[model samples]
Target: MTGIPKTYQRIVLAARPRGPVAPENFRLETLDVPELADGEVLIRNHYLSLDPYMRGRMSSAKSYASSQPLDQTMIGGTAGQVVASRNDYYRVGEFVGGMLGWADMGVSDGVLLRKLDTTRIPLSTYLGVVGMPGMAAWYGFNQILEAGAGDTVVVSAAAGAVGSVVGQLARLRGCRVVGIAGGPEKCEYVVKQLGFHACVDYKAGNLEADLAAATPDGVDAIFENVGGACLDASLARTNAFARVALCGLIAGFNGQEMPIKNSRLLLLNRVTLRGFIITEHMEFWQQGLQELAVLVANHQIKYRETVAEGLAAAPQAFMGLLQGHNFGKQLVKLI
Candidate 1:
């Protein structure tokens, strides 16, 4: 490959967090680009996705997936262009999305890579709305929630990547959507920008009352992202036979105990709650991505992003994301 850099920078997981993740948990290192194997592909990562799931991966505690190995490039999704290829299936100059981790560049054997089409959707979106986050929204709404016309759907962390999509999708399905976000700005964006019916500011110190006022008909479906108070408030407003898709528990991600205060409502209201990991259902990804791509390309589905420039900013950007400082999808522009 002509003009390929001899060395690249990558962020490695230097230490496991005892509680909240800090900058010290990651270490930046420079390494020589590895020689590609007979069936390998070299990728120059343009963007690295910063997701809440990566927080769980940082812990050694029992989880659905293995803990991220220490001193290794921190695991993450990336969108990039192939700089070199030794495989027939993928060619140099092709755009791709893969688990390339937090690096300026990486090498893969072509097994984990998926070719991307950036004609309509931007390449960075493949790591966002038309990618895993979008898939999670689609699958959770359509399969788990099973919401329909006249249903009141409440989405926690509604201004974020997955929650934003979930609310929009529910609205498209003729359901009334209410969003729960951090502050006035995010709440306003949820209602005005994302077209949600109403948005509750969870930071206003009146979550339960505000949520109740917003969801007058009671919440028929919930796409829960932040648990703790958000979940408790939503649970208190659940309608009979209400469906809940528990996608993330960001409120408790920093090792806080966030027990549900309204657990009795599950039995009282006959609520059906299901927690899912999107990776566990890879079969529906293609179908969901196709639908999401079309909607996004047509502008029926709008999304936002908060990008931090350079690979060096990932840890700080990630910390911001955890603290709800980001507007939507958070990414590190590695290029």
Candidate 2:
């Protein structure tokens, strides 16, 4: 065994919640790190992204992949600086992206972790805009939704990590952007800050009307985020042959299972709905990243992160995200 001291610190999935995940679902545990094999590097985790999909992973049932087995370390996508390396590909000063889960430190084979240029983009960007969230926007808007200039594009969760980028990119493409967020401040940010043409607040108790007022010509494309009432309302207003990209359903994350309604209406509306995973669009990553970097560098786009200071506070931060309490991207700064 390579002489790397063993240590353990993990958020174990103690139990699956009956509804939205609860604090008890995770228990902090400490264990020894396995010795680093050749071609492996150890990272001292810096920032861990808290995404909506983590909600599904917490459930003990199958969704996209294997469920987080009970009593095991929870899974997450994290960015960290390399502290030790046995692989020439990853030096001690290099930053990396990997399945590091939620811990202060972790070891992985060079295959699972990719070196990142921290000088070009902040390490945090690897977990958001220049990373998975950016990837989600590239595929959802360009490939899945196929958004076009002058087309009316509506995106729910518009002020979030993914939706925010989608809205700005569609606007950059000369599309009319309409965004749906939870409250008035977020709505204002979407319209005034992100340059979206219109925005609505689903929490206003009149989402349907506000939504209608935002898209008088009807929506040509929609990037769905909160998928209960918002999805239903968007479907009702879709333009002929409109397209929809199903990204996430935070509405159902808390056990509010909304039945897919108006299934027959797709035949009438000629709407095309596609569900996508960001990993599927690995090919288009560079094209999107190059553009996104320019936007960020030029201040054409902005991002907000509701950062939680310690790894121990991650569960609370994650819960806030699922509950719409977070103002923007949710993250845990372990370093």
Candidate 3:
């Protein structure tokens, strides 16, 4: 970075969003890069991750995390290379991953950054299947859902990054896996590519009927990512002594309030529903990542990505992600 440009590009939250995020909610700007202090490193970001969880940060809601400040660089996961380093632990030119936000370059004190090995998998994958999303799936499905052989496991938003891994891992454990996705194309990918027993198209307008037809044995476990009608349908089809991983409520993230319509089923089915945030379960992450890395490296677990080119594309790409447009992991390429 001796002769590198002194400025960096970034996007910030222009205003707090009231409902569905519009392009107006974000602002793009450039600023001169600051000189690094001791124990700090300068990162030239190559990829920025777009996820449904970002929507929660835009609002001042009582969520698992605190609200992101307005008019600041929006919070997000990023993978990049260290262009300059004052930290002895990390060397320059080494790829790293951290929560560096939506920027072409960022500075860090090495507290949150992790060194990445691009020789094993694609560098961008650190933001997807081999990273946080994959850990979420592993912890949510194994520890929470607890589905085993002869059981039927159903996952909502099952074609996205986390859900894709959850269904595939359930299948590996010999469970009958069913996926709930938005469109016919995603449903096809969920069943054909991910090897789920069946996939129900929720956007097809017959969620209850489609789910019922897919899981005739009644859902023995659920790894729920989407809420609202998708959750309602799963609750209706759950079996006795079933377990559920209430991972995320993507359908209600944008201020849509959807009340559960079938509370009676919880009592009748003896279901166990637990909500979790992956960060809170850091104890399991190292083991989970090691296993997930092997699965990903050996192609035992498959994933897809819908990459949006450039940092400016992040805002629109994120809006599309909330609406279920991305195929697998939604990532913005900042190279």
lDDT of 1 by residue, 142-174 (tens): 999999999999999999999999999999999
How do the residues 1-335 of candidate 2 rate in per-residue lDDT, one tens digit apiece? 34444785778788888987789888998888766788888888889888988888877665877787888767899999888888988888788988888888888887878777776668898788887887898789988888788899989999999999999889888999999998999999888888999888988899888889988998899899888888888887888899999988889987777976756657788999888877766789888887787777788778888899987898989889988887667889887
TM-score of each: 0.99, 0.95, 0.99
Top-scoring candidate (lDDT): 1
Question: What is the TM-score (0 to 1) of candidate 2?
Answer: 0.95
Ranking by lDDT: 1, 3, 2
lDDT of 3 by residue, 1-335 (tens): 67777898999999989889999999999999998899999999999999888999999878779999988899999999999999999998999999999999999999999999888789988899989999999999889888889999999999999999999999999999999998899999999999999999988899999999999999999999998898899999999998889889998887889899987898999989999999999999889988988898999999999999999999999999998999999999998
State each model's CA lDDT, in order: 0.95, 0.85, 0.92
RMSD of each: 0.6, 2.0, 0.8
TM-score of 1: 0.99
Return the number of clashes found in candidate 3. 0
Question: In candidate 3, which residue pairs get closer than 3 Å at backbone N, Cα or C atoms, i.e. clash?
Answer: none
Scored by lDDT, model 2 comes in at 0.85
What TM-score would candidate 3 get against the native?
0.99
